[model samples]
Target: MKNMEPRIFFKSSRNVAADTGLSKVSLRAGVGAFSLMEMMITVAIIGTLAALCMPAWTKIKDNSMRARDVSNLRGQAMAVLAYAGEHDGVLPGRINRGVAIPSTVTTDSKRTYYLSTVLIDAGYCSKDDKIWKTVCGYGADQFGVAYVVNSGKSSVPTYFFGNRSSTAGATTYDPKRIVSLKSNLDPDKDPKGKDEEPLSQIWMITNADGENYNSSTTGGLSNSLSEDVRTPWGGRHYVYFDAHVEFKRSGEYPSVN
Candidate 1:
């Protein structure tokens, strides 16, 4: 070492450091470039995390949508109840089992009281696209909530519907209860209510057959409830005869009487 020149020693040391730095650089480069297995593991971890989060995220979204729907129905229920109160407790539109007749507002022409004419038009409820248009996903004629009547139950007789345009206007139960609208209701005459109730109906029946209980479509009376459509997110919504609202799942529908 003493025989070694200082300049040569310094040069050797510098070369050693450069080589060491190059080696370190090579090591770091190799470390920075992940192997296929490493990449796969990272991907798997991300995928697992995503899968874990998806259900929760989906639940939150569904809950949010359901809440909005329930709120809409509640408002609609209130309006229907109010309308009934003013008309001596008559609900607009008449529904037996399969038969649905629009409430007759004018006797001259039989202007069946549809949702728009009976409630929205009469200023009982408002149907802004923001409320039920986009949310309900139906056109003006077939948008908003539904109005159904009783078809009777094993325990109760066929009850009456409050038809505002009814000739029995302002008369409580004046219009004789049609037998067709009863426990063994004529499926053809009963246009709206499903099989669970003795009286009254749901706010909106899911996205049913675009017919009776298709609360999404509020304007026309042209079709029937889809045999398959019930509440989509979970169940349907009801604002019953008692002015109470509840979310019900399919097959476990609450009593609307």
Candidate 2:
């Protein structure tokens, strides 16, 4: 029997050189290329993500504006307090029945502020009339007087408080007797009535008409109260008796404690 043996074959240099054209390095490097469909799909996905995020971004911007309005209201409140302090504790009177009195501070953009008072004297009302009625559609009358400040001919009014109105036959509020101050930057416009409440009467109790920033009324100081109506910016700036100024949203009056 012939002996069987395994033999290995190795190529010579000339043989290797002849096979070099068949090497796959170029093809391997080119494997990473993306097809047109793949590229298009990736772009579409990114665009969709951007669209989904836009609405939320807009909402955040709106909230920021609302917060700024509140801040301006607070500032006006502080300004009024400072004015009162320097004037012997006597609050400033309105220009007319419903008009705000201009401040001595020239820095206030020539806007006028309102002042009113509530008297706590006796013989005003009978014991039964002692119970106060709610004013301006805001629940029960907790505060006696509401001093209103008109920042400008914008929307909404800045309001301040004393306590509640006295009963009939009693001394009403006196703008000359302001002591301490509390303020609210209400977004609502002055309330309305056929015989619209006088600025003096409104100051006496919570008798402001509804915050009618959008109401259509004519004549008298009522026009001054309505000046803030239909604000193009959709809100108004107000300075409260406490020396705080705030921007209030239309139809949403702020209340201070």
Candidate 3:
């Protein structure tokens, strides 16, 4: 018989038995698995990254709230201007709701009504309007803080309304300054309207500081517990007579001419 070549058998990579020690062991040790130390290091790195991003995220959220406040103030200002246009160039200050303007200086004329109430009663805006609300607060309360005015006296609305004009020399609220309409000064209505200050110089509305109940802590508005009023951000929004809105830093206020 002719000499036969010895036959050798070789297994393909896929044909290797999984039960064999050589086949079961990974070529690169721990390539697909994480050690305890590796896992802890990964968690620490993720926490560090999140901590670094927190302040930036907080700033972004604050800016968004401020912008919303500015927009709401602008809308409220427009409503006030519209109300003035129909009422002989008179703004809503010391005006009673659902009642005629007092002709002579009397108790009724001196009585102050809430700006929101006056606006709502005149069909200018609704009570549920977001423009009447703000996102600023101290402690847990948010809505009640924005309207604080004149240090929050009893039975008085939280907004301050300076006298825009007087009718027949009637007593006016914050009677020191006379307000003008756009560029026109109604001499008959405002006897002190000689110097027509720029509309931008006069701030019609703004967030004020006062004491109010903390609804979150006090449980509701009925509680007598009060807290200082403040905005969520560090600045307050001002609405000028020209219906323009601007923001001022905390402790800074508008200078009215």
Candidate 4:
């Protein structure tokens, strides 16, 4: 038997070269590979698209938080009105931690009475309520509520009830001296009980930062912001005495009489 030439079944160099060329063509036409520049361009496009979407996403997130804040405030407003209805239309916020009945309870005898304290103690709202917090206001942990209850400086029918006590057990809270939402600040000057202003015009609550509420001025009703005023999109939410809510930008406070 003629020494069987080692039966070589392998393809020739020419055939191999042709097969390799066909494979390359198939790859280029079927699953093409990206060059370095093409890959970089794709990545860059993706990054630019993401950058373009960021602002809209941020705006959506902010608006959602704002809506939640508005809802929370509206609920609190209802709670306040309910408390007032029960208390003969008298607003809450007398004692920080006790029945608001006329008492000689002084500051030394109890925690500093906050305007929100009465609402919490009277079951109008819980201390843990989200309404007590704000997106652009100080945390509830800092104060009883994120919104300023009122200036609370004057009792001459200025607005909101004032803390008559200096410290714990330092003074008496006379029940008869209590004022309600309908109390006329200028009854002598204006015989009309309307006080020459509508309830809608009277702002009852707002983001402490928007109002630049200071603890020194508000007697700790809110924590002071000495730095830049932080608001949601340079705007803040307001809750009126009529339980109406509104969003106004900085320097856009309603022209209230």
Evaluated with TM-score, which candidate comes out highest?
Answer: 4
Clash number by candidate, in order? 16, 38, 0, 10
Error of 1 at 50 (Å): 1.2
Model 1 poorest ten-residue lDDT run: 95-104
lDDT string, candidate 3, 64-141, tens digits? 888887887787788777887787666666632111111211344333445665666678875564765555444322
TM-score winner between 1 and 4, please give it. 4
Model 2, range 12-79, lDDT digits (tens) per residue? 65555467753355545557788899999999999999899988987776666545544533433343
Q: Put the candidates in TM-score order, highest first.
A: 4, 3, 1, 2
Which structure among the candidates has the greatest lDDT?
Answer: 4
Between candidates 3 and 4, name the one with more favorable TM-score: 4
Angstrom error of the Cα, residue 233, model 1: value is 3.7
lDDT of each: 0.46, 0.36, 0.52, 0.56
Judge candidate 1 against the unseen true structure and give its global Cα lDDT, from 0 to 1: 0.46
User: Which parts of model 1 are misplaced by more than 4 Å?
Assistant: 1-38, 93-112, 130-222, 254-257
For residue 15, give model 4's deviation from the true position in Å: 10
